[model samples]
Target: MSIVAFDLSRRLVAEALGTAILVATVVGSGIMADRLSEDAAVSLLGNTLPTGAILVVLITILGPISGAHFNPAVTLVFALRRDIEVNAALAYIAAQVAGGIAGTFLAHAMFDLPILQLSATARTGTGQWIAEAVAAFGLVFAILAGLRFRPDATPWLVGLYITAAYWFTASTSFANPAVAIARAFSNTFAGIRPVDLPGFIAAELFGALLAVAFAGWLLAEPKPPTTFKAAE
Candidate 1:
């Protein structure tokens, strides 16, 4: 089906649903992992796998509809690039944020945990800030490069990159502002305190923008190979 097959409302629904599922996978798996394993490493691995696997599935299925951008930082990049209109980007961000929060609540309900809770898990300091920046940078960079060189493999590229980022980044790769905000509502393994939201969000946005700028240059077609004439 053509991308235009869906209307704006339908596309919005797709975006919301995709983001919800992604968040649910992240939040729910984190909760389950934490409960099932006493080893923090084992729990983190469990959480990491589901999050990465779900991203590949979600993006492949939902991408044709809404480009499968479940993160506000991503939407911001597209908006800056004029790939998506400002108004639509705003709407997408709204849907993403709303859907993310709902996903957190859904996970809570599924786990029979308290519905209302705020994360007290502090994720702060310059290290975390830099880590967040690096995480977002890598995430956006992967998407940009994958789209440029291999659109068909973009989903896997993103999934694999994020999986690596989860282990490599100090902040556990909360590269998405929406995901971070949603995670804040659940004080489980994936949670980040609301107070830390600003720094992470800022770092993520900054990193995303940097990726766009760098990709613009990096992905450019090499200028036609030209050779200077030898002097007589």
Candidate 2:
């Protein structure tokens, strides 16, 4: 295959695999949390830890393969930053949304709660909105900086950033639209309300876009010699 064609195929396969892993981890963690404890804090940890761990591992594993976008908003930010091609970004985003829906259904089936009321997300008012914005900005900034200027630092840095965001952010650090949508199906401990999904996703995506724009303006173009290095 030509270089461009090979790159295209790799991206699609990576999106499929990354999304599968993301949903599996998210749904699996929710099921475990439901069975383990009813306390909100314990449940939070149970859900966040698994998701964080999975994200860390998957980003490390799939970052080179597909930039480990795993989320539609992330892809949007990358596209806006001109780090990814438009067509590929659209394809990745579509894959993410579809994967999220599939993941939610799978989770429902696995838990024998096909109509289970997921732990839908709902954080309204000014304070909650601010919190969500901050969380999304931090997440996208970390990803952009890590990928652009410090590729070698991604694995652990990305993991740690997500873990911290989960604990600190008021929205429980959703940071990912696809994951948010997928979590709505579990209804066990980490589901978001379908009604609230659109607004929350908008906030998160807008925040990420702002971050990408700011990062581009504030930071130098990632024209460092290493930027040209091939993904491993």
Candidate 3:
């Protein structure tokens, strides 16, 4: 057998690659927004819409290959739901963090930003915290519901939800840990404050855990004879 067989190691590598792609798109879009727009809200949406589109496309393309986690929050949810094992979840998280940093650095190089001027972990006060919680809860809830009723629709629905959340939430709905980490690299409008990383992560984790507990009850499996097949 090949040394890197179809196993956790390969899956971890795929997570790394997926996370890297995610961050590249995220930060690159931020660079584009900064270069192109002066209106912060418009700039935020400009970056977010495309980021959502890319996320859906990438997740659809890479979900089977690596589960397309790209986020520790998602990985942890999957693990809690028994969709992935512990070791694999840990590996996925590690890859995600590494890939996020790599993607930030790549964006730094691409935009010719100062080495330390990249975005940081986004955070907000109480109102924004509530917004983040709601956004994250909505995302995980939608994912679980899709998995239960329409597995084939998961990617697209997720993308749409994220896109909407970006506009709706006060904090612009940064629901993923890896995405937050990657955002830390850009000093553009999308940038988060490094000092606020802990709060953002805590809010996200709270949302995730809350979603996990409720997801099982909220999302029951589809009725018999309606088993979901993979998307085409």
Candidate 4:
């Protein structure tokens, strides 16, 4: 169906469900990885692979329905670009956050863990903040650039970028505000402390704004002639 044909309710459902599944995969994989491996590196590899793969799958499947943002940072960027209405962006953010919470609970249920708990994983400090900023910048830049020049490849590009960022960045590229918030509820390998969220969220927003600014300049259309003659 065309975008216009899908009503707001349908789009909101799609966003919520997609974000829920994405977060579930992230949290679930982290739990499973931790259980299955003693080596920290190996557990991280397991978590990274599944999270990236699920992102590719989810974006490819849900993109046509809801644009498959699944992240408040992404939704905010689109709202700033006027690609979506402000109210719709707010609704989307709400759905994403709620879905993320549900996903964490679902993962906990599947893993037979506590359904509600605060993470004590302290992922803060200047190095971590800088890493988050850099990670968010690269993620948004790749997305905007891919959409401009290679729209069909955007899902894969994003997945690959996140997979790489998981290894390269200190924060493991939590680049999403919704995901960061939800992760705070779980005290697992993938969790971030609730207190550490502001820095990561701020870094993410700053990076997204930078990407938007850069994309506007890089993708602007050529100017038309200013000295046009009057028609006869």
Candidate 5:
């Protein structure tokens, strides 16, 4: 039905569960892809497809419940837009972060790797930071434009955009802060160094805010012209 049909608790649960599964998909697929391929490109393709596919599925199924935010940057955008209440937005962010960490652990457990580990994969430099910003800008723009133009197609739009962004972006488009934070716990192909986290998160947030500003002007509907009635 509608997003408002669900209560805050249910919405939060969906957000948590959806984010958990999303992080699991990213981490688990990266591990599997790395194991299966010697070619970095092949492994990345392997990593990208499952993530794109799962987004389509997860957003389709969960969009009605929590609007399928799954990302703190996205939640913040909505909070800024006043689409969701401030307190609820905070709760949603907390749930997403918690779920994302849990998802990292879940992937580790499934792969029989150590659950508690810090990522040492160094993802830094100006190009990488700029790439993360661009990636997040594309993501938030995609979501907003999709909602404005073709609400029914948002799931596919997001999935396909991310699929392409993963290849194009130097950082492979870890556009979600929660996802970035979670990935920092796993030293895998999808992972980023814990030390690299602040830059990525900051870039992601800045990009998301930019999208909101741009979309607010770009996607907004024109107001009806004011008419003065003839003097009676």
Candidate 6:
């Protein structure tokens, strides 16, 4: 269905539900990976694969409903581009953050882990911060570039990018403010400490802004040249 076919409430629900599922996949897969694998590399691959696959499915399913923006950084970028209204963008961000938290709790329930616990995982450093920025920048850039050039390929592009980022980035590419906040609530393998939230969030926002600026310039429509009659 097209975006115009869905109302605001439906769109909000789609956003919340999509984000919830996405976070559940990320956290749940991480937990399962850690349990099943003795090798850190294997565990990371397990976590990365399912998260990327689920992202492709979720985006394909929910994109038309809410633009499939499971990240607040994404919502902000769209708002900055005037693609979505400010009030609606605020609503979307709220839905995404709340859904992300709820998703963590759901994963905990499924795994019989504590539902409410702060992460002790200390993910902080200059390198980590830069990685997060780089991750976020690449994520937004891939999205904007895909949407502009080949909207049909966006899901696959995003999935592939995240899968690669999970390996390449020091921070494993949280790349999303809402996901980072939700991750802080979990003590699982994918968790990030609450203390490190500010740095990650700041870097992510800056990265998204940079993507907007860069994409705006790179993707701008060409203007028609003014014609001058030759001494008519």
TM-scores of all predicted structures: 0.95, 0.84, 0.88, 0.94, 0.95, 0.96
lDDT of 4 by residue, 138-167 (tens): 888888888888988989998999999999
What would the per-residue lDDT of candidate 6 be over residues 1-232, giving only the tens digit for each residue? Answer: 1244678899999989988999999999999999999899999999999999999999999998889989999999998888888999999999999999999999999999989989999999999999999999999999999988899999999999999999999999999999999999999899999999999999999888998899999988888999998995
By summed lDDT, which 10 consecutive residues of candidate 3 come out lowest? Answer: 1-10
Residue-wise C-alpha lDDT for candidate 3, range 1-232, written one tens digit per residue = 0012357777778788878877877788877887788888778877888888987887887787777778898889988877787988888899999988787778778887775664444466898788878888888888877877788888888889998998898888888877777777667666788776677788888898899789877666556886688999
Q: How many residue-pair clashes does candidate 3 contain?
A: 6
Of the candidates shown, which would achieve the greatest TM-score relative to the real structure? 6
Clashing pairs in 2: 118-187, 119-191, 119-192, 120-191, 120-192, 120-193, 121-192, 121-193
Candidate number with the higher lDDT (4 or 5):
5
RMSD of candidates 1 onward, in order: 2.3, 7.2, 7.3, 2.8, 1.9, 1.5
Model 3 Cα RMSD, 1 decimal: 7.3
User: Which runs in model 3 stand beyond 4 Å of their true positions?
Assistant: 1-5, 118-122, 221-232
RMSD to native, candidate 5: 1.9
Model 5 Cα lDDT, one tens digit per residue, 31-63:
999999999999999999999999999999999
Model 4 bad stretches (over 4 Å):
1-4, 223-232
Clashes of each: 0, 8, 6, 0, 0, 0
The parts of candidate 1 lying over 4 Å away from their true place are 1-5, 226-232
For residues 105-208, what per-residue lDDT tens digits would candidate 1 score against the true structure?
Answer: 99999999998789999999999999999999889989989988898999999899999999999989989999999999999888899999999999999999
Q: Alpha carbon lDDT of residue 132, candidate 3?
A: 75
